[model samples]
Target: MTTITTRTVEYPADNLTMIGYLALPAGAERRPAVLIGPEGTGLSDVERRRAEALAELGYVALAFDLHGGRYLEEPEEMLARCMPLLADPDRMRGIGHAALDVLRAEPRADPDRTAAIGYGTGGAVALELGRDGVDLHAIATVNALTTGRPGEAARIRCPVWAGVGSEDPIMPPAQRVAFTEEMQAAGVDWRLVVYGGALHAFHHPSVDHTVRPGVGYHPRHAQRAWRDVVALLAECLPVTD
Candidate 1:
């Protein structure tokens, strides 16, 4: 296993003091970086572990915060907060850019070689950053096939990849069509992968807290999605020794 270091980082975003997790590979040589966005429930151990995994792969990774430092386990509370945030593109960009700044500021991160990967609400933020014309080398999202304003997608300059569960009610077929149409119209290099026999948040593990119907875990699909995401990164943002 590659040696890596992890730490907590604090930054300002969405009118709150966001607490994020930073993971860096061993050595002082600068390396490609990735911005990790967590689901609407906020930053948790899941995202932190992902960052560490990326670090082990030799990329600096930062798991950004969503709701300050709170993790909303209640579905009602999560929806109430995420619904409004999702409706506002500018707000989402603010959060994404703030986290990007933190990632790029890291001494070991090569700011010019960066990508953003997010889940759920975080995925929406990642899409917003692309739509806002952030210079991302690659963008990948799971369970957040959100369509942006009118022609904003044309501003995206990098390849985009999205993963979704076949039975995700929140991101139904029509929504997926709309998202793909937007990407196609913008002439962006994009692809979508639908995991068979899965539902919303299939990539996430089953939680102890109550979750909405149609939301459950699929261990196999989750691993498959992670492999796909890693493949996307390898293609768009390869790490060098």
Candidate 2:
């Protein structure tokens, strides 16, 4: 196994102090970087572990914060915060760019070779970054099949890949179609993967709470989604030794 290091990173965004996690590989050489966004519940061990795993794969990864270090356990609270943020592209871009700044500041991060992968609300942020023309190598999101404002997706210059549970109520078929249509209209190099028999947040194993209807974990699908994401990164943002 490759050696990796992790540390807490605190930055300002949305007029709040955002605490994030940064993971780096063993060597000092600059490498492809990844901006990891957490779900609406905020940054947790799930995202931190993901950053570490990416570091092990030779990429500098930063799991940036979403809610000023607050983790929302209640479904209502999470929805209240995320819904508005999703509707406001400028705010989402601000949050994403703040963390992108942190990631680029790292000595081991190759700014030009960066990608963004996120989950849920975090995924939406990743999409917003691409829409804002951040010059990402790739943009990948899970359980965040949401459409952007009209004509904004044209600014996305990289390959976009999204995965969602077929049964996800939040991202139902209509929403998926809208998202795909937006991407298609923009002429983006995009792909969407639907995991059958899975629901919203299927990649999250520890979220056992019945926070809402049609949301649960599917362990097998979770693994498959991760493998797919890794493949997308390899194709679009390969890291060299």
Candidate 3:
């Protein structure tokens, strides 16, 4: 088995010190890298594990924090912090850029061959990075399909892929249409996949009692989404052997 290393990294963003989890694959040669953004509940073991998994697949992965090192188990707290942050594109860009800086600084990361993938509120952050004109090969998001300001998406030069649950009220059909229209108007290479019968956050595992209303897990769809994400990375930012 290929060796993998994990560590805690600290950086500054949005006027706050943020803690991120980084995973590196074995070998000294530089490889493609990915920046991972967690759900609105903040960075948790879920995102950390995803980073490690990516490292195992021969890519450097960094799962950055959203709320300093705290994980919000309470729905209200998560919304209170995420809603406002999502509304401010500048703030979201700041957070994404901070983490991207850390990832690019890694010796094993190929700065020019990088991608961004996020979940929930973190997904919006990833989209913001693409909209802010960050040079990335690909961008992927799940369960967070928010549309950006007029003409701003044109700044995104990378191909984008987004996945959401078809029944998710948070990202309803209308919202999905709007997001796709924005991508279309921007002339971006984009694709959207709606997992049938799935709910919001279907990619997320159950966290305590946080499962409520339109939010729950669909194990089958979750695995499929991960595979789709991996495929996206392979197509856009492949790590050659």
Candidate 4:
């Protein structure tokens, strides 16, 4: 197994002191970087582990925080914060840019070669970054099918891939169709994969805390989504030895 290092990074975003998890691969050579966005519940061990996994794969990865340093286990709290934030595009872009700046500042991250992958609310932030005209090699989102302002998707300069649970009421078929239509109208390369028989947040593991109805995990689909994400990165931002 390749040795990797991990650390906590504090940065400012969305009027909060964001605490992000940064993972670096074994070598000192600058490498392709990726931003991992957490779900609406905020950053947690799940996202940190993902950053570490990406680092092990030879990419510098930073799991950016959404809620300062706290994780909201309560559905009410998560929605209270995320709902309003999701409605505002500029705010999401602010958070994304702050995290991207921190990632690029790291010595091991290659600023010119980067990608963004996000889940839930974090996924919306990733899409916001693309709509804001940030240069990215690739963008992938799980369960976040947010459509941007009219004609804003024209700013996206990279391929976008999104995965969602077929039965996710939060991101149902209509929302998916709207999102894809916007992407197509803007002439951006995009694709969407719907995991059959899954629900919202299907990529996430089941938790002990109370969750909204129609939210559950599908282990098989989660693994498949991860593989698809890795493939997207390999195709768009290959890490060189």
Top candidate by lDDT: 4
- Evaluate model 3: give its lDDT: 0.94
TM-score of each: 0.98, 0.97, 0.98, 0.98
lDDT of 3 by residue, 7-126 (tens): 999999988889999999998899999999998999988899999999988899999999988888888998899999999999999999999999999998999999999998899999
TM-score for model 1? 0.98
Which residue segments of model 2 deviate by more than 4 Å? 208-210
Deviation in Å, model 2, residue 73 alpha carbon: 0.5
Off by over 4 Å in 3: none
Per-residue lDDT of model 2, residues 1-241, tens digit only: 5489999999999999999999999888999999999888888898999999999999999999989999888888888998899899999999999999999999999988999999999999999999998899999999998788889999999999999999998899999999999999999999999999899999987553445788889999999999999999999999898
Error of 2 at 66 (Å): 0.6
| lDDT measured at residue 189 in model 1 versus the true structure, 0 to 100 | 99
Q: How close to the true structure is residue 19 of candidate 2, measured as C-alpha lDDT?
A: 96
Across 1-241, the per-residue lDDT of candidate 4 in tens digits comes to: 5599999999999999999999999989999999999999999888899999999999999999999999999998988999999999999999999999999999999999999999999999999999999999999999999999999999999999999999999999999999999999999999999999999989888873356799998999999999999999999999999
RMSD of each candidate relative to the true structure: 1.1, 1.2, 1.0, 1.0
